[model samples]
Target chain A: AQTVTQSQPEMSVQEAETVTLSCTYDTSENNYYLFWYKQPPSRQMILVIRQEAYKQQNATENRFSVNFQKAAKSFSLKISDSQLGDTAMYFCAFMTHTGANSKLTFGKGITLSVRP
Target chain B: EPEVTQTPSHQVTQMGQEVILRCVPISNHLYFYWYRQILGQKVEFLVSFYNNEISEKSEIFDDQFSVERPDGSNFTLKIRSTKLEDSAMYFCASRGTSGGETQYFGPGTRLLVL
Candidate 1:
């Protein structure tokens, strides 16, 4: 079974500053995918970014990016120019590439607070 | 962009009652999934469906839990006998056919068992 771990339970960042959420996983598969999801106070889980294990280049959205170290089984999310709206519970997820029936294994999550 | 939508934003049900959660995944997606997050816990996968059948399910998805894609646009999760432990946020998600595609999630339905 694959497992994702988010060591940080809670994180805070001043508005306009940057913050990084740590994530690690245990998997024997070499090809897989990693994702970062944000759940705001409204309880809506939204996709923030994704990274394919086969690709060494990290994935970046407008304000979100990931540092994916495939060999180390580490995938971290970085939020740049953080805003109050960025405050949310962030989850790290892992999906294997082998099967069409792959399911996401998620981390416990990290609560982020972008303080003003 | 298309998004997944879930019905009955919140539901309150008796401990032994049956509850059905509905979801409408993105129109073009082929694979669907149901996940649950107990209060203050990580989201856990319940089941994954494709081609109108269950493709994968976790141990938590026991006989009490079932999933169906009754139609093209709707995917549903039914719990035969609800328990207090079932009171949590349930989210529906879908992904395109492309391998390892990113999944889009619904806002989630909060279930309360009293």
Candidate 2:
């Protein structure tokens, strides 16, 4: 079984500032995928970014990016130029690369509040 | 861009009643999944379906829980008998075979079992 841990339960960032949410995982598999999903008050789980274990380069998406340390089993999400719209519950998830089952094991999530 | 969609964004059901959450995956997606999140809990996988059958399931997906991709376009998760503990937000996700491993998600259905 895979376990994802987001040590911080809540974080606050001033608008236009940056925030990094930390996440760590325990897995024996070498090949897999890491993801950050954002769930706003609307309850929709939106994919923010993803990182493939094989890719040495970090994954970035506009204002969202990931610092994926494969050896440390750490995948943290960084939101640059944070906006009030970015305030949401963020989840760190893991998926196996071997199969089509592709179920995401998610962390408890961190509530991010972007102060206006 | 095409997106996965789920119906009855919220549901309120009595304990012991059966509830079926519906999802319409992206038209060309090949894999579907069901997940649950209770209040402030983490999202947990329930089951994964492909080729019209279940490909994988978690321990939480016991006998009371079942999934079906009936009629080719709709994927549904049926809870035979609901318990108070079953109240949670259920999310439906779909993955395309061509994509680089990102699963698209629906808005989710909040099931309140009272």
Q: What are the lDDT figures for the candidates, one per model?
A: 0.92, 0.92
- Cα distance off (Å), candidate 2, residue A78: 1.0
Error of 1 at B14 (Å): 0.3
Query: Model 2 chain B, TM?
Result: 0.98
lDDT of the structure predicted as candidate 2 = 0.92
**Model 1: CA > 4 A from native:** none
- What are the runs in model 2 whose C-alpha is more than 4 Å off? none
What shift in Å separates residue A85 of candidate 1 from its native position after superposition?
0.7
Q: Best by TM-score, which number?
A: 2
Q: For model 1 chain A, where is the 10-residue window of minimal lDDT?
A: A95-104
The DockQ figures for the candidates are 0.73, 0.80
lDDT of 1 by residue, B1-114 (tens): 788999999999999999999999989888899999999999999999988899999999999999998877999999999999999999999988755388889999999999
In terms of docking quality, model 1 is: medium
Reference contacts recovered by each candidate, as fractions? 0.73, 0.85
Chain A, candidate 1, TM-score of 0.96
